[model samples]
Target: MAFAANTALISSPTLFTPSKFSSSRLYLSVPYKTTKFQLYCKPSSSLPLTSLFCLRKKEKSVLSALSDDFPAVLDEIEGNSGWDVAVEGEEGEGGFVVQPPEEAKVYVGNLPFDVDNGRLGQLFGQAGVVELAEVIYDRITGRSRGFGFVTMATVEEAEKAVELFSRYDMDGRFLTVNIAAPRGSQPERAPREPGHRIYVGNLAWSVDTGRLEELFSEHGAIVSVRVVSDRETGRSRGFGFVEMSTESEMNDAISSLDGEILDGRPIKVNAALERQTRGRF
Candidate 1:
């Protein structure tokens, strides 16, 4: 069977024998791109197969014409999958996309602060050719985020890297290595809104960002934690900001954790304010 376009291919496409569909020709009234779908067609004895099948824009036109003339082709194709052709730039909705088993990218998590982009690629090179390595960094602090991504030449190399370096100790931290999810695959986080930031007063002098995260994490997903410090002294100023993912989480932390005893100090939690003297209460 002759295909209209090369890019329009089905998943596990079958090569139809020339003896079967020697004159099989398909005409899609669509403009540029033809979408993917399986074509199940067999010649009928009573009414011979037409040399060409044309699918049109109007539903009634195609249905009425095919039902009257080429019933077999119309019934099988439409019943299995509908015509989802695309214009020059428009993308068609649901159809089987032929893709490889796994992506060539690997996620490397819990990395040490010392690891750089080059070193990460060198480490993954033991498995195969490392195409690219990237260590994520905190944009504001300009510090290593302790996690990065490594891209190999092929999916097989990525799988090999995962087996060799998963839980592999670097310095002291055991690495978390696995195939990375495709871009835009994960659900996007909700945007932060007003009242999402929480202010905690009377915090212990030792209470820092990490410590504050451990305490309030049980309430909801946290955006960031900052234990405010004096300009001169590096010590925590007994107050900080805990940015939650949403306003409800901020309210919950305030109601549940306010006055909670920590390091012999009862902490106060409230909505963060923009005013400088807001923490006076």
Candidate 2:
């Protein structure tokens, strides 16, 4: 019976069977008609060979299609089965084998702030075909977060990128490249606080409440803008607060303004935390 190349080898007896035996291990030949590849196995001591190595009937194959040639089988599966990494840690130690995250996604860090997705893709394409590239941006400022992700066409290609591009210099800055963590492994961020107020910091000395309002107004409706000034000097204290007309407007302002460059300096913006007041004893 012809099996899809992407199909799991365990699916059919003709593809993988106990063909050769050594003292301790068994060599299973994965044959697609005329082409043969050996898959090494240590047979289970307690189960029958068929029971231990066979695949279920209903499950779909992992490869793309059954082919008459070996290289085509690699091509078929390379495009179809995404990385399904399985990682297990040892007791008291982190000894494990992890497949590249989600098949071919790679993390790129220490990037220049000006590098966009297109530039990043072109840079990574040197290792292999890049399927997609994206740079994370602050929601308000639309400025890059100095990191991004790239998905390669295949797992081998992703590995090649890590091998060649990790520590690669781009305009004097070295980049950090690695297999991206699976989505489930990422930490959950705390929800933004309620209230239409946001904190803005790292203001240019020349920036006044008016300029602040004008800059943020492009993002949303602003209720008020307050630049905190020094109590003694009357000069700008270099920080301020902005109140948007609504929570949505506040969020928009945060997303657009944080990481925004002003006077060659990136500003910090975030949801306003409630100010703590001293309690009378």
Candidate 3:
């Protein structure tokens, strides 16, 4: 089959033969309008295969007209593999809050304390469109913890952002960006020093301080267990805290059951830091 500079050719299995002349070249004999012609040379090379195909000037014009549709064909090829090619500023409505598509990449780690959505968008948008930026905050003080997420619009952009900004510095601190691992993929955290409380979530509706103590007491002596509940309703909110006698025991407990699904729901178990109480409520 003959092809132009930007043209691609598809050949039937029997009609295509590997070239004995060069590894990158192929030979094809095509029958068109009662005449047969032999084609040779590399279709991928800079020279167009027209030199061998005997296409007249008029026929070349038709081929040129067909070339206009190549991008759309290529777009279809890209679409089949979980990629969507989009032009700049044309992404649909809704800002960063939208969940990044499964193919989208995310970044994590320390960020500037004052960083906002716009700044984050500008920083990551350089690599690719930034779909979202969020800074986790302390519940009480509402202060940024110098960490946040930046979700890129596409996998390629996400990968590019990670490569370009993983160690880029802002406000005198180095940033950490990478393909965000799926949630709960992080390794179990080592237990904190003694006296640290463990945050427990996804408790069964019937769970309470006594049940929590009973469950966690197997690992070590339980200092205390408190199931946080709604102040007005007195119903369990499905979270609690447990203080172990030693950090080693806490480590064992967390390692054994941090994400263990119990009673149809996966539990979130982690070392809980001391709660900062800023003035009594």
Candidate 4:
């Protein structure tokens, strides 16, 4: 994700706090011009008196206006700055926006080839409500992609799910969890039909298209093998796709090669599903 440019202006303390006091409070004897200054008082006197002074007009200087009430006042600052602090929950409490539970949508990545929907749900269901769990499979091959998605009822539950199952070990493999993006937005593609292409990752750095084809050909006939290469470096990306002559071959290749040791490296295979053509399709 790319972040927008941020420019912050730091003001000297004197610029923000009230510089002029009531003339009545200004006395010749007073070292400072003002005396009997009516400093802003916090509802709770237990707070330090220093917090009553408001210093610096710029948004960054609001830190000088430190008080229990500071959060409330900062909330009133209208504009982009409000959103920056608000999203961070700077108030030290749950902010106005409620975060969905952790289990809302579970991202199950780095999976072993054999994991399926039932196993994925059973694993996460241990933590909280699992509305649904599915191991993405190649449509043509019907093989596990080593990753899946799970959905919980709420954001809080979703968060809990991630915390509880992010590193969950099942069948001797550890899983990774992130708040799942909406359906169809995952990196793994669905299985394409005969002559359909899909991505393969975690390949041995030394493996090439011909080597991959030769290795997977035992399961089925490979029509084409394309190893994605870096544009700048012009080197194999350690991943690529194999287009099979038939859907059965695709599935056979996925089941046989996925998670199987190839040249001493474990490979992950899944169907390259169609890319979502439209939003929410």
lDDT of every model, 2 decimals: 0.67, 0.66, 0.61, 0.59
lDDT digits (tens) for residues 133-251 of candidate 1:
99998765676767999988889999999999987867644687889988778945345335478889998898876788789988987655667767565567889887776778788
Candidate number of the best lDDT = 1
The estimated TM-scores of all candidates read 0.35, 0.34, 0.32, 0.33
Report the C-alpha lDDT of model 4 over 1-281, residue by residue, as the tens digit: 11223412122223232466443221121121111112222233243323232232223322232335444544443231222222222243344434444437777875766678888888787777777888897554465655788887677777888888775655444566888766556566546434455567888878866687677767765555656767676567888887665778788888777787877888889897666466672
lDDT of 2 by residue, 1-281 (tens): 32233322233445344555444432334533222122222222232233223212222333333234534433433333331212233233343423333869999986766799999999999999888899998665466766899999889999999999987877534677888877778755445455588999998888876688778878776655667777576678888898776787788888887999987778899998775555672
Q: What TM-score quantifies how close candidate 3 is to the native fold?
A: 0.32
Where model 3 places Cα greater than 4 Å from the true spot, the runs are: 1-99, 184-281
Worst 10 residues of 4 by lDDT: 27-36
- For candidate 1, the per-residue lDDT at 188 reads 56
lDDT of 3 by residue, 1-281 (tens): 54445433333323333445343332334322121222222323343223232211122222222234445543543444333222211134332234667546565565655787678878888897877877776565465655778777778888888888876767534676767666767755445444657899988888766677667877876655667778676678999887766789899889887987766778899998665455673
TM-score of 1: 0.35
Clashes (candidate 1): 0
Number of backbone collisions per candidate: 0, 19, 0, 23
Candidate 2: TM-score?
Answer: 0.34
Candidate 1 regions with alpha-carbon error over 4 angstroms: 1-102, 187-281
